[model samples]
Target chain A: MRPLRRLVLAIPALWLFAFFLAPFALVAKISVSRPLVAQPPYEPVFSLADGWQGLWDKLSRLTLDAYALVFSDDLYLDAYLSSLRLAAIATLLTLLIGFPLAHAMTRAPRQWRTALVLLAIAPFWTSFLIRIYAWIMILKDEGLLNHALLSLGLIHAPLSIFATEAAVLIGIVYSYLPFMVLPLYTALEKQDPALLEAAADLGATPLRAFWRITCPLAWPGIFAGLLLVFIPAVGEFVIPDLLGGSDTLMIGRSLWNEFFENRDWPAASAVAIVLLAILIVPLVLHERQQVKERAA
Target chain B: MKRGLQPFHLAVLALGFGFLYVPIALLVLYSFNASRLVTVWGGFSTHWYEALLGNEALLASAFVSLRVALVSSVLATILGTMAAFALVRFGRFSGRTLFAGALYAPLVMPEVIIGLSLLLLFVGLGIDRGFWTIVAGHTTLGLCFVTVVVQARLATFDRSLEEAAMDLGATPLATFRAVTLPLIAPAMLAGCLLAFTLSLDDFVIASFTSGPGSTTLPMRIYAQVRLGVTPEVNAISTLLIGFVGFILLGAAAINRLRKPQGSG
Candidate 1:
């Protein structure tokens, strides 16, 4: 039993260490290395055959120029800022929309609640790229939205929504709405209705009861939903790339350009490292919160 | 206790569902349009769907995605089940915090960082980036999800059944195989399906990890979508949506079937 348990533990631990944790170390190492024109596109490459001394030599030769450049360049800075701003706005928008939807789901007839929840989650099972692509067909200049508006005489010309930040926001909110709604629904569904009834008995208005009782009870879900939406939205590549125009500067797109188009592995790694650094705290805190919740 | 959905709440639900479903409905509608221009309707036709059948590039990439999803989801399920057991059953162990962290981090880690980092690892190890590397990256990504699902099931699992089997003179292995496996089978199946869909739907990780010849369907779709929208793309997108919808419905039906038995 002891040996079997040990084996069970070791297999996944080793796999994650090799594939998940070790890669971060590699990214950190390559971030400080210089870009080369050769294959693999980075220099001061470490080889295991060279042993510790060679590793030490490679380590010593690693430069901070990539980091310096990431900090000094306005492109990287703007991309990072834009990503944060867009992600924050998107998160707020999802919460505004998701909260009411979740509330509605919980308020639904008891038998209908499960079906409603499933309906909310149905979009998530579809291919994310397809969902985003569906938006492109709707939001484009000559798309259905404009055609509908034009026929109604509400607008003289088509709205230029596609390839704009507005399009990206819509794409993000649409794609991730399920993520935000699920958590909020789960949290809301678990609440005791008696509390609201009790508040009403005490002469509390619906709005006041919602603020005092519902909002506080929904805090964990709100936090979880915010992190779920905002974190991924910040590094969202497809939504921004496909929906936002060339003027949209996102760190994820910039990172792709650096590695794929520019062939600058060091610079891309630097960008990744910085992005990771920014996100690690919230990620760790979220994980810790999850652990605590599970344990409790 | 008598409170029900108000008109305001009903309105929100209507708008919310509309926001979610309208685009999908439009995509399906446009796929049937005979027009070369996707937005313009030129009588209903199935020509685009027929065109999709002959597109070798799209079909090849889809085959690649299917193979990757099949293999990687299996790999993720195995690793994830083990990790879930370790976390839930093993309790306190050395490096348990780290183990939990590593297991859950991928859930929220940005895809770009995950992709870039894994690519660097493969390059550093002198391994060629291709189908297998995408499998590895996806397996890593998918396992975290599997762990979360399986862990939720494991947390709520009843251990007394296993203890009863052991008291009846069954070995621990036999008890686990007989009692635990059957009980958790639904959750495991759910985890595998989740992993499979995640791998199938992935674009970013697959993009960074794939080599010249290993383009997945999403990669292919992304490339074509970048150039311009086509009715053919809509046809394929509608097909994928339909396929995934079928799977989710089937899963839901299975869940409904299992619930009565569990409660009984």
Candidate 2:
């Protein structure tokens, strides 16, 4: 490339290197270091200020106690499992709800389709914190739902829905519904209707046609929506923090508590590394799929 | 081929929209509640909104968030636009894969990991955690969104105009300045708006990076909401929702206007 073009690429390239890629390297380094009680709260296992020999010496002496603790402890294991389970469940729920909504959008009048799409995605552009906060208001005991239920004489008392696992699930589904619907909508909308009509003309039932034609075509959308919701939902912090009960354990929340509440930077870094390892599998698979799709 | 709307589809649409919007509508409704109790509506009043105006800490944090969003979004847009140009125009280059990975990873990476990792990097470098640190963190996050937006626009871009400009003896830089910049300006603006909203809405990253006095509005909201729900928070959230909603609607309108007829 010419010098000007090289310069254009180098600026962002260098910025990402320094800010994005380098941070993970730091996290990996810190995860192997010892936690301390001093300022910054971690023993520096390797430092650039040290000479190559000294750096080699420190690196050789680095401890894996943080990772050991993360593995040996059931708390960390449960947190990881819980996070994965919750994310999986939320992804499934979102798909179930999103698929029909996306289908409905594709079937709507062409003039109304754009407006409907806008309505569906508009909430996402608003503050995420506010959206979750909105749930807190609605789900709390004596909140709107309970108030309405009681006024209608449906129940004798308010339901204690706030700060529960169910509430967290509700929050996740609500917050991530758009992420699920948009991709599914895109995928569903692109499919040729003639294929489905041809199936019906061949005497196949609507259900059979949907299963054979629609579902197969929507697989890409399903996969995309699943990852889009599952990946972030696994690492979600604010939703569970605000909506979940005290006993709720998520890897993201665990990492936050380890770093801020306990001030154990090394432990927190270890948890983060493990979480990244788990997420990398799906992310890499998704990348390979995208590359394959592009090539095709 | 037009399919008539079925009752099942109508029900699905109604229930789906209801699930998505009922909570927000309730929150907006209760923001004007006269009662201190959120659930019990005494009468329609704007007392909570008035109270928000007088809260000093909230106002201070709002100012901080606005400033951070402005600076970081602008920085993100410039760098992101350049990155988009590199990706679209420069077909193959050394480190292209790595560059693309780094740019797109932040979009899917969880905020906590990003926050924690960035904080550790700042601490490792002996840099103080404050306004600038938050800016750096947000700029990293925002630039990715900007890049995605601008990249989409660039992919479908018409290059004939630029070729024509070059054929007329306009230098590459001159052509870019006169033709390319104006054409992609809308996408860049959209990207900047997206970045601004991301920065403003961010809480976890700001909490991790902020020092003594650099609390953003989301951080402030999180702190208060954790203590307990209050009408004042409802008021602030309602205002933010309204502001962001207006901006998004405006963006959609602009996007619609920019499209060629019958294309959308």
Candidate 3:
């Protein structure tokens, strides 16, 4: 019994330890290192030839320059702030769009439920890169959207909203709408028909019933969906990079540029560490929500 | 029960579905466009599809992405199923909390942090960053999802059936094989499908972990899109989307077939 249990325990533990936990420790280690012109582009923690002298030298040379650089620069700061602003607004928009759709799915006939669920998840199977790419096609000048609006007589000229913050918002909302709806639908689906009926019977209007009954009942889903959208959206790189113009300053893009374009490993690691640090709060809350769901 | 679904809810859902699908529809529609300009609708042609056959880089990347998705998803499913089993069946062992913590952490960790950290780990360990590294990276990201899905399925399972198998003189492993594995096969497949698509669609992590020769489909698409929109991208994307759609349909059909097996 014990050996079998031990074998069961060892596999996942070793894998996570080697792959997940160790990598994070390396990230933390590299964030404090100095960037150099050498291969790998970061100074080693120590050299074995110098023995204790090298250890002391490494300790002395491990400066917080990367941390200082990120703090000193307004580009990273603005990126963080803008990412937060964008993620927050996008989360709200996802909720507004997802709630009704999810509610409708819950209320849908049983046979149609599968179809609705498939419809919801169908796009997720497709390439995310492509979905965002599709938006570029739609929103570009002389694109389908502008052509339609032009023909519809909605406006005299094409609205050049592409490459703007609004486009980024659209991309985020479009991409993450499913995340919001799936959880919300799951929570809303578990609602008792009796509860809503009782509220309606007790002189509550439909809107009032939804507010008092459905909203409160679906709080867990709302919270789950919010965290799901917000955390990823905050660190979202692809959407803002592809859809956004030069005016947009998002941290994920900045991190990419810092690493790839600048080849500054330490600086990029510091940016990532700080991004993780700021995002740690919601990440924990999300874990807590998952635990609660599992427990329930 | 007087269940009244508001007209507003139905409309909103319709709009949401429209919003979700129209871009995809447009991409499919334009993949056949005779015009080089993505926006202009030329008469239908199969030229872009022909063009895709000649692009070696895109073809190679697509092949690499498929291989990586297949390998990583199979690996992730096994590992994640083990993690799920441990969480569900192992019962209050030491470091269980830590195990649970590690299991859930990747689900929410930002791709940049995950990607950057793992890349650094590879460089630090002197491991080559290419196909295998991507498989490792994807498994790390995807295992959590599989664990979650399998764990949910396990939570609803009937433990007494396993007991019944045990009572029939079957060993624990046998019981699991005969009883548990069959019961949870659908969910496990679903989890694997999830992992596969995740690996298929992953751009950020693959970008960070992948070295020169292992460009995936997303990486290729990203590079192409960066150069600006082209009908070739539309054609390729349309094909990829069609492939995924087929997978989903197969899964749904399999699920429908499984229901009768479960009942009988």
**Looking at candidate 3, what is the lDDT of residue B118?**
85
Tell me how many clashing residue pairs each candidate has.
Answer: 0, 0, 0
Q: Which model is ahead, 1 or 2, in terms of lDDT?
A: 1
**CAPRI-style docking class of model 3 based on DockQ:** medium
Name the regions of candidate 3 deviating beyond 4 angstroms: A47-50, B258-262
Global lDDT of model 1: 0.92
Candidate 1 residue lDDT tens string, A172-251: 99989999999999999999999999999999998999999999999999999998888888999999999999999899
- Which runs of model 1 end up more than 4 angstroms from their true locations? A51-56, B252-264
Q: What is the DockQ of candidate 3?
A: 0.72
Write down the TM-score of model 3's second chain: 0.96
For A125-168, candidate 3 gives per-residue lDDT tens digits of: 77789999999999987788998899999989998878999999
| DockQ of every predicted complex | 0.81, 0.69, 0.72
Q: What are the root-mean-square deviations of the candidates from the true structure over C-alphas?
A: 1.6, 2.2, 1.6
Across A237-257, the per-residue lDDT of candidate 2 in tens digits comes to: 999999999888999999999
